[model samples]
Target: MTDPERELNFAREIIGQRGFRDVPTDEVLGEAERLLNGWMAGDFRMERPKLYDHYALLLLALLQKNRDLEARIEALEARDA
Candidate 1:
Protein backbone atom coordinates (compact mmCIF):
# COMPACT_ATOMS: atom_id res chain seq x y z
CA MET A 1 0.00 0.00 0.00
CA THR A 2 1.11 3.54 -0.72
CA ASP A 3 1.74 5.99 2.07
CA PRO A 4 -1.43 7.93 2.84
CA GLU A 5 0.34 11.24 2.96
CA ARG A 6 1.98 10.54 -0.38
CA GLU A 7 -1.37 9.64 -1.90
CA LEU A 8 -2.90 12.78 -0.56
CA ASN A 9 -0.08 14.83 -1.96
CA PHE A 10 -0.46 13.13 -5.32
CA ALA A 11 -4.19 13.85 -5.39
CA ARG A 12 -3.52 17.49 -4.59
CA GLU A 13 -0.96 17.71 -7.38
CA ILE A 14 -3.37 16.15 -9.85
CA ILE A 15 -6.25 18.45 -8.93
CA GLY A 16 -4.07 21.52 -8.94
CA GLN A 17 -3.03 20.69 -12.48
CA ARG A 18 -6.69 20.28 -13.37
CA GLY A 19 -7.20 23.97 -12.42
CA PHE A 20 -8.20 25.16 -9.01
CA ARG A 21 -7.26 28.71 -9.92
CA ASP A 22 -7.49 31.40 -7.25
CA VAL A 23 -8.62 28.77 -4.77
CA PRO A 24 -7.17 28.92 -1.32
CA THR A 25 -4.40 26.45 -0.57
CA ASP A 26 -6.33 25.21 2.44
CA GLU A 27 -9.35 24.43 0.28
CA VAL A 28 -7.29 22.55 -2.24
CA LEU A 29 -5.52 20.68 0.48
CA GLY A 30 -8.84 19.78 2.03
CA GLU A 31 -10.11 18.45 -1.27
CA ALA A 32 -7.05 16.29 -1.59
CA GLU A 33 -7.60 14.94 1.90
CA ARG A 34 -11.21 14.16 1.07
CA LEU A 35 -10.31 12.44 -2.16
CA LEU A 36 -7.61 10.39 -0.48
CA ASN A 37 -9.97 9.40 2.26
CA GLY A 38 -12.62 8.35 -0.23
CA TRP A 39 -10.15 6.38 -2.29
CA MET A 40 -8.83 4.58 0.74
CA ALA A 41 -12.37 3.66 1.69
CA GLY A 42 -13.10 2.42 -1.84
CA ASP A 43 -15.71 5.09 -2.41
CA PHE A 44 -13.95 7.06 -5.08
CA ARG A 45 -14.91 5.15 -8.20
CA MET A 46 -15.97 7.05 -11.27
CA GLU A 47 -16.61 6.55 -14.97
CA ARG A 48 -13.53 6.24 -17.11
CA PRO A 49 -12.39 9.34 -18.86
CA LYS A 50 -10.60 9.52 -22.17
CA LEU A 51 -7.41 7.61 -22.72
CA TYR A 52 -5.48 10.86 -22.37
CA ASP A 53 -6.82 11.29 -18.88
CA HIS A 54 -5.53 7.86 -17.90
CA TYR A 55 -2.19 8.54 -19.48
CA ALA A 56 -1.96 11.93 -17.83
CA LEU A 57 -2.52 10.46 -14.40
CA LEU A 58 0.07 7.77 -14.99
CA LEU A 59 2.58 10.30 -16.28
CA LEU A 60 1.98 12.57 -13.36
CA ALA A 61 2.59 9.77 -10.91
CA LEU A 62 5.74 8.76 -12.71
CA LEU A 63 6.98 12.32 -12.88
CA GLN A 64 6.34 12.88 -9.19
CA LYS A 65 8.14 9.65 -8.29
CA ASN A 66 11.03 10.56 -10.56
CA ARG A 67 11.21 14.00 -9.01
CA ASP A 68 11.35 12.55 -5.52
CA LEU A 69 14.05 10.09 -6.57
CA GLU A 70 16.02 12.85 -8.24
CA ALA A 71 15.94 14.96 -5.11
CA ARG A 72 17.20 12.05 -3.04
CA ILE A 73 19.94 11.43 -5.57
CA GLU A 74 20.97 15.06 -5.51
CA ALA A 75 21.12 15.07 -1.75
CA LEU A 76 23.28 11.97 -1.73
CA GLU A 77 25.55 13.43 -4.40
CA ALA A 78 26.00 16.59 -2.38
CA ARG A 79 26.75 14.61 0.74
CA ASP A 80 29.38 12.64 -1.13
CA ALA A 81 30.76 15.73 -2.87
Candidate 2:
Protein backbone atom coordinates (compact mmCIF):
# COMPACT_ATOMS: atom_id res chain seq x y z
CA MET A 1 0.00 0.00 0.00
CA THR A 2 0.99 3.59 -0.51
CA ASP A 3 2.21 5.70 2.36
CA PRO A 4 -1.04 7.59 2.71
CA GLU A 5 -3.02 4.37 2.62
CA ARG A 6 -0.79 2.76 5.19
CA GLU A 7 -1.11 5.75 7.46
CA LEU A 8 -4.87 5.68 7.21
CA ASN A 9 -4.87 2.01 8.11
CA PHE A 10 -2.59 2.66 11.03
CA ALA A 11 -4.92 5.40 12.23
CA ARG A 12 -7.91 3.13 11.98
CA GLU A 13 -6.07 0.46 13.93
CA ILE A 14 -5.17 2.91 16.63
CA ILE A 15 -8.73 4.15 16.93
CA GLY A 16 -10.02 0.62 16.96
CA GLN A 17 -7.66 -0.36 19.74
CA ARG A 18 -8.26 2.82 21.68
CA GLY A 19 -11.48 4.70 21.30
CA PHE A 20 -11.19 8.09 19.60
CA ARG A 21 -11.51 10.02 22.87
CA ASP A 22 -8.86 7.82 24.47
CA VAL A 23 -6.15 8.09 21.84
CA PRO A 24 -2.73 8.99 23.17
CA THR A 25 -2.13 11.83 20.77
CA ASP A 26 0.75 13.29 22.76
CA GLU A 27 2.68 10.05 22.81
CA VAL A 28 2.07 9.35 19.15
CA LEU A 29 3.12 12.85 18.17
CA GLY A 30 6.30 12.61 20.21
CA GLU A 31 7.34 9.33 18.61
CA ALA A 32 6.48 10.59 15.15
CA GLU A 33 8.54 13.71 15.66
CA ARG A 34 11.53 11.73 16.91
CA LEU A 35 11.41 9.26 14.03
CA LEU A 36 10.95 11.96 11.40
CA ASN A 37 13.82 14.05 12.76
CA GLY A 38 16.09 11.05 12.99
CA TRP A 39 15.24 10.06 9.44
CA MET A 40 15.84 13.56 8.11
CA ALA A 41 19.16 13.90 9.92
CA GLY A 42 20.45 10.54 8.66
CA ASP A 43 20.66 9.25 12.21
CA PHE A 44 18.22 6.49 11.28
CA ARG A 45 17.92 4.30 8.23
CA MET A 46 14.91 2.35 7.18
CA GLU A 47 14.35 -0.14 4.38
CA ARG A 48 11.10 1.67 3.64
CA PRO A 49 11.20 5.45 3.54
CA LYS A 50 7.45 5.73 3.06
CA LEU A 51 6.89 4.79 6.69
CA TYR A 52 8.53 8.02 7.76
CA ASP A 53 6.37 10.07 5.44
CA HIS A 54 3.30 8.26 6.64
CA TYR A 55 3.98 8.99 10.27
CA ALA A 56 4.84 12.61 9.54
CA LEU A 57 1.52 13.16 7.83
CA LEU A 58 -0.32 11.32 10.55
CA LEU A 59 1.39 13.43 13.19
CA LEU A 60 0.32 16.65 11.55
CA ALA A 61 -3.24 15.49 11.16
CA LEU A 62 -3.44 14.34 14.74
CA LEU A 63 -1.98 17.56 16.05
CA GLN A 64 -4.45 19.63 14.08
CA LYS A 65 -7.38 17.53 15.25
CA ASN A 66 -6.23 17.79 18.85
CA ARG A 67 -5.96 21.54 18.60
CA ASP A 68 -9.37 21.82 17.01
CA LEU A 69 -10.96 19.70 19.70
CA GLU A 70 -9.31 21.68 22.47
CA ALA A 71 -10.52 24.93 20.97
CA ARG A 72 -14.05 23.65 20.70
CA ILE A 73 -14.01 22.48 24.29
CA GLU A 74 -12.68 25.82 25.48
CA ALA A 75 -15.36 27.66 23.57
CA LEU A 76 -18.07 25.45 25.03
CA GLU A 77 -16.75 25.98 28.53
CA ALA A 78 -16.61 29.73 28.06
CA ARG A 79 -20.16 29.76 26.76
CA ASP A 80 -21.34 27.80 29.79
CA ALA A 81 -19.50 30.05 32.18
User: What are the models' TM-scores?
Assistant: 0.38, 0.45
The candidate scoring highest on lDDT is 2
Scored by lDDT, model 2 comes in at 0.58
Lowest lDDT sum, 10 consecutive residues, model 1, at 45-54
lDDT of 2 by residue, 37-72 (tens): 655676655446456445654666587778989999
Model 1: number of backbone collisions: 0
Per residue, candidate 1 scores C-alpha lDDT tens digits across 13-72 of: 446555544544455445545655676686554223432243454454556657878999
- Span of ten consecutive residues with least summed lDDT in model 2: 1-10
- TM-score quality measure for candidate 1: 0.38
Q: State model 1's lDDT.
A: 0.53
